[model samples]
Target: MILITGTAGFIGFHLSQRLLRDGEEVVGLDVINDYYDINVKYSRLAEAGIDKNEIEYGKLVQSTTQPGYRFIKLDLTDRESLNQLFEAEKFATVVNLAAQAGVRYSLINPQAYIDSNIIGFTNILEACRHHVVKHLAYASSSSVYGLNEKMPLSTGDNVDHPISLYAASKKSNELMAHTYSHLFGLATTGLRFFTVYGPWGRPDMALFLFTEAILKGEPIKVFNHGNMVRDFTYVDDIVEGIKRVIENPPKGNPEWTGESPDPSTSKAPYKVYNIGNNDPVTLMDFILAIEEELGQKAEKNMMDLQPGDVPATYADVQDLMDDLGYKPETHIRHGIRNFLDWYREYYGYVTDQGADAGAITDQKKQ
Candidate 1:
């Protein structure tokens, strides 16, 4: 059996569906917190065939659509309950994707980051330690590369200077995972995800916010005076990389040495991979792709870089390629168009004003 935390989340939902389709018995966990919109979270759960009416807090409920999949309304911080779940399930693999996400929100509520990213992750580590799980794959973020002027953020790069509480928590997660792996011989892999965007993505992300604002004729906030870049990875590609990593857990690197250590791998059974497109798209070019797809221009509200925000992010996926023989290949134009199609369909927005589904490729070629 496989345990996937944050199954109600964007990446979690897609991953669970994919695994279930592959005939894996998946036990999913989520508290369904209203960090953004509860409605959206519930909608994602519904897509997983989990009826809200059937959910009993802290109890496991089977998916109505997929028999191999089940979900539990639980919190990672609830250590005792989490341990019991791990004990009973005896999962062969675990993917920890649940974290208090968002860069700016950490400034408003720092405690949320501490509770979920720190304490929750600690609980996960403890459970994995006691239960003897085979492999643990968890989500890290590109934001950990904060304050670095490097072009392509690599796992080999030092991430000691985190600008936001969220980034610090993620960095702490990597450190904590290493400790566990070194001490207990637990196989763990941490994924530093770049700017992931796609259908059913988080509302707080730029893609969702900009799309909603454009459709409503509102001004979309363009921070850093519209001068920024992101390795906007598609959700599917991120999941694919994760799947590959899960199948191939890190066996302690034989060449690792203390005098000259690689930040991505260690003598312990642990590894870190940069899961991204490796293509940094300018902020303006991304917006233009959206505009071309929607056939509408956004009213831009230029602003200075917000506190706890980086000006740009690029991912170096060479390690990922060499290890897993996989790379994210989704282009911005195609990815944006995919998101637009899902947004329109999910929100019941009429397509009369915008180009039809798959027209994003056509517009990109023009």
Candidate 2:
């Protein structure tokens, strides 16, 4: 069976449903904490066909309908429950998507990062070490390349200096994984995800926020004077790439040398790859796409760059393309429209008051 953390999350929920549909047994886990609107998360669980009443914190719920899919309300930091689940499941593959996710939120609550991203991930590594899983694949962010102005960020680039606590925690996850791979010969792959957006996306993300603002006829805050760029990848493409990687597990690099080591791969069966659309879209274009989807014009309030926010992000996915023969092809315009449709239906929103400049400006101050 495959065990996936954060199965109630955007990526995790999609991945879990896909795997189950393919006749694979999947054990899914999530804390179901009130980070955003718990209703959206609940809707995701419902879409996955998991019964709400059956879910228990840190306890697995077997699928009555799908037969192959199961779920549990669980936190990564719960050591005792984590260990018990790992021992019982005997998962052949483990996907670690559970973590304290937002970059800005990390600044406000650094302890959350330390608990979920660092200490919590350490427990996953320890569990994998004892369980003998064939592969341990986890989510890493492009934010790890913080403060670097390098065009088209590559996996080979040095990520020693990270600007946000979120970025630093992700870098720490890599280090911790490498150590386990070296000692226990575990095959660990860290996927560095770019700006991912689509249907059922997180409410805190740019696309969701922009859609909400535009539909309400509110002028959205354009950060950094709208001078930012992101490789906005579609959720379907991301999941396709993930499934391919999971099928073809990485082997240790025998040619790896200590004197001149390659950062992307190691002799200890550890590797990192950037999974992205590889097409950087300007922030203005992104906003325009959202406006088109909502069939409304958005008022723009240009502003300076926010702390821990990068100006641009472009992923070099040549390695991913070569390894899995995967290429992300979904355009932002199409993806934005799809998301807006889901938003209108799911949120029951039918308004066109754009947020006053004063309200959003106050949000920025906080």
lDDT of candidate 2 over 245-333, digit per residue (tens): 88877888899998987888898889898989999999999988777766788999999998999899999999998888888989888
- RMSD values, in order shown: 5.0, 4.7
- Candidate 2 lDDT (Cα, whole model)? 0.86
Give the Å shift of residue 174 in candidate 1.
0.2
TM-score of 2: 0.94
TM-score leader: 1
Q: Which residue runs of candidate 1 sit more than 4 Å off their true CA positions? A: 351-366
Using all chains and alpha carbons, the TM-scores for the candidates as numbered come to 0.95, 0.94
